[model samples]
Target: MHVLVTGAARGIGAAVVAACRAKQHRVTACDIDASALAGVYAEREGVDCVALDVADAGSWDSVLAEVWARQPVDALINVAGVLRAGVTGELDPADVALQLNVNVRGVIYGTDAAARLMRGRGSGHIVNIGSTSCLFAVPGNGVYSASKHAVRGFTIAAAGDLRSHGLNVSLVCPGAVKTDMLEQQRGDDRAALTFEGKRALDASEVADVIVDHVLVKKPLETYLPGGDQWKGKLCTVLPEVFLSSVEKSREKGIRNFKSPQH
Candidate 1:
């Protein structure tokens, strides 16, 4: 399978590229940072790197043309994302818009373009990387949470729309993972996040879940560590009470994070 993965320079995207390579799948990894992409792959075959920003339409079209020229893309994974810390009172609208542009609009563009190609050939899979934050109301990161929720909504709708046309769609919602994104968020309130100061899951774990689900042809939505899947469901079913409690917990947690920023 010829697979195209974005934001593949580090973290879960990198891990996913590695996993697909191990499975003997042809992978094209793209990222805006050339050094980040270069540092990871010493000598990788069946994998080529492209420096492309997902938020730019012209850049995406150019990259997609390059990808198509090399090989027909059998699968496209939209893993590019940004994490921001902000609340309604202290957040910049531009930051929030940037988050949506990268996290939501990026997925939309990739999915739409890939789906059009796959529909003509009658085969393809599109996997979107979302966060467990979509499941609940994260206190200071309300904007980030909302962006992910949009991803989830789009993934579900894409699944329904693409099924009849012989296309596959799945949303990979991973919990906390060890990555630079979280490190950059040190000062921000992490109280609203699941598992305080505890290592949740690694990028490799998330990659495994994503690859396994894709191979098995699972449903449009797949939540990693299905055991905690109920929490997201509960959050959806009881948004008012659940979100109120989460906000309270986040306020309490931020208090501990004031001086040290941990």
Candidate 2:
């Protein structure tokens, strides 16, 4: 299969690229950081590296066109996202825009572009990387959570809309991951709730689920830890109660964030 992955410079995106390559899939690895992307995959065989800003619709158009011209893409994984931690009332306007642009709009643009091409071919898979935050709103990361909520809704709708055209659209919502993003949350009170998980997931663990299960099963929605789905569902069904409980847990999460274990 020919796969195109955004945010391939590091974290889960990079792990997904490696996982796909291990399965012998031809991959086009893309990231906003061209130099970093090149440093990681330029020397690797069966992988083509490209620079892309997933937030720009025009960039998606041109990038997908160029890639398709060389080889039809059998799969597209939209993993590029940004998180800016702050209370909603105090968040920088620029930070809010950045999160909405890169996380929500980026996923929409990439999925729409890829679906068009895949529709014509009559078969393809599109995966969007979401977060457990999509299920429950986090205090300091409200905007990021909202963005993933949009992604979750969009991917599910897209799955139904595209299934008739032989396209599979999936949303993978993982809990806090041990990436640079997680590291950035350290020492930030606003992001304390993000550290509440017992243990952060390795990027490869999320990547493995995508490559091994999502791609094969083509499920519309998947939660990385499996247990998170129930937690998310419970939170949604009892937001008032859950919010209070979650608030109480924030201190523990903060301790986890500062602890050596994290």
TM-score of each: 0.90, 0.98
Q: Which tens-of-lDDT digit does each residue in 1-262 have in candidate 1? A: 8889999999889999988998898999999897888787757888899888888877888888888888989889899999888867878888888999999989988888778778988888899999887786677778888899999999999999999999989888877676777666655664345444234577888888777666567567777667446877887888887766765566555454442323
Find the candidate with the highest TM-score and give its number. Answer: 2
How badly does each model clash, as a count of residue pairs? 0, 0
Stretches of candidate 1 above 4 Å error? 190-194, 251-262
Per-residue C-alpha lDDT of model 2 across residues 160-210, encoded as one tens digit per residue:
999999999999999989899999998888889888878888999999999
Which runs of model 2 end up more than 4 angstroms from their true locations? Answer: none
In model 1, which residue pairs have backbone atoms overlapping below 3 Å?
Answer: none
**By summed lDDT, which 10 consecutive residues of candidate 2 come out lowest?**
253-262
Looking at model 2, the pairs that clash are none
